[model samples]
Target: MPDVRYVTQGTRAAIRRTTREDGAEFVRLARESAAFHRPWLTLPTTERAYLHYIGQLEREDREGFLVCVRETGDIAGFININNIVRGAFQCGSIGYGAFPPAAGQGYMSEGLGLVLRHAFGPLGLHRVEVNIQPGNKVSIGLVKRHGFRLEGFSPDFLYIEGAWRDHERWAMTSDMLDQRTGAG
Candidate 1:
C-alpha cells in the first residue's frame, strides 16, 4: 500500500504526495488520456517509466503531488514543482496535467489553489513559473485563472514529443498570492 500523505486540502479536492503504489493507476490514467495529452505533454505510461518518474521526484529539487477528488478519492490530475532553487531565488518551475475524466470540470482549478498555498506556506517558495505551449489554450487558461501573469515567450523552449516547441512563460509570486487574498 502507498503511504498516502495529504499535502493540502480544498473544498472539492485534496493534494497528496505521489507514491510508489500509485504506479499502476497512474500509468493506466496516462495511457487512457494519451489523446488528451498528445503533443502537449508526455507522461509515464509504463511501469518502468513510472518507477523512474517517481525516482526523479524523490530528488531534492523536485516534488510531485496528485490532485484527488475529495468525494471519491480518485486522482484528478498531477502537479510537479521542478528545479527548485533556494537562497536568493526561492523559486521553482511547475508542470501539470489534468486527466481526461477531470478535464474541464474546474477540479484542477481548486486543486491548483491548494498547491499554491502549499508552495507558499510549507514549501517556502517565493515564486512559481509555468511554461505552456502557445497552442495549448486550455493550459494557458488554467494558469490565467490561477493569477499567473504572462512573463514572456521562448522559441524552441522545450523539446516535446519529437521536436522543439515554443512556449509562453507565466509566473506568480508568493507576494502576489498574498495580495490577491488580502493577506499582504
Candidate 2:
C-alpha cells in the first residue's frame, strides 16, 4: 500500500495524501486560486464539476496526491501524478500548481523532489514525465531544476486556457532521480 505520511519541510509546508474527506477544502482552495491556477489547472467554475473531478481523483489508482501547506494550514500547492502504468511502461506523468502566495518560494520544487523519490523508488516507476506548455517558464524551470531532460515537443498535448496547446516534453528516469537528489 502507498504510505500517506504527513510530510514536512521545516516550517515551510507539509504534504499528505488527499482523501474524499478533503473535498471541501480542496474545492475552496481551487476556487480561491482560480485566477492563478486556471491557466495550468482545469479549475471548474461550477460546484458540480468540482465535486466530480475530486471524486475521480479520490478513487483512481492512476492518481496520487501531495497536498501541501504551511504549518499554519494555509494552502500552498498541490502535486498530482496521474495515469500510472506498469508492465514494460513503469512510468507516470506529473502535474502541479501553486497558490499565488506560494509561487517562487521553492515549495513546489521541494514537494516535487519528495514525490519523485516516492514515484521512482518505493513506487518502482522507471520514468517520470512533465508536460508543460511551451510558455510556462515557471514549470519548465522547475522540471529542469530537478534534472529532467527536454525530450521533445508534444503537439496538442494539453487543453488549457481555451484551446489545445503544445507542450515541451521533459523526462527523467530513476537513474537521473538518484543522481540529482541521492535519494536511492
TM-scores across all candidates?
0.96, 0.86
lDDT, candidate 2, 1-184, per-residue tens = 2233564343466667666666666677777788876566676456677677667666544565554654555556777777788889998888888866777787788778778877886778999888988878888998989999999998988888788988898999999988876655
In model 2, the Cα lDDT at residue 20 comes to: 61
lDDT of 1 at 36: 93
lDDT of 1 by residue, 86-154 (tens): 999999999999997888888788888888888998999999999999999999999998899999999
Q: Judged by TM-score, which candidate is best?
A: 1
lDDT of each structure? 0.91, 0.74
Give candidate 1 misplaced runs (Cα > 4 Å). Answer: 1-4
The CA lDDT at 141 in model 1 is 93
lDDT of 2 at 51: 72
- In Å, residue 29's CA in model 1 sits off its true spot by 0.1
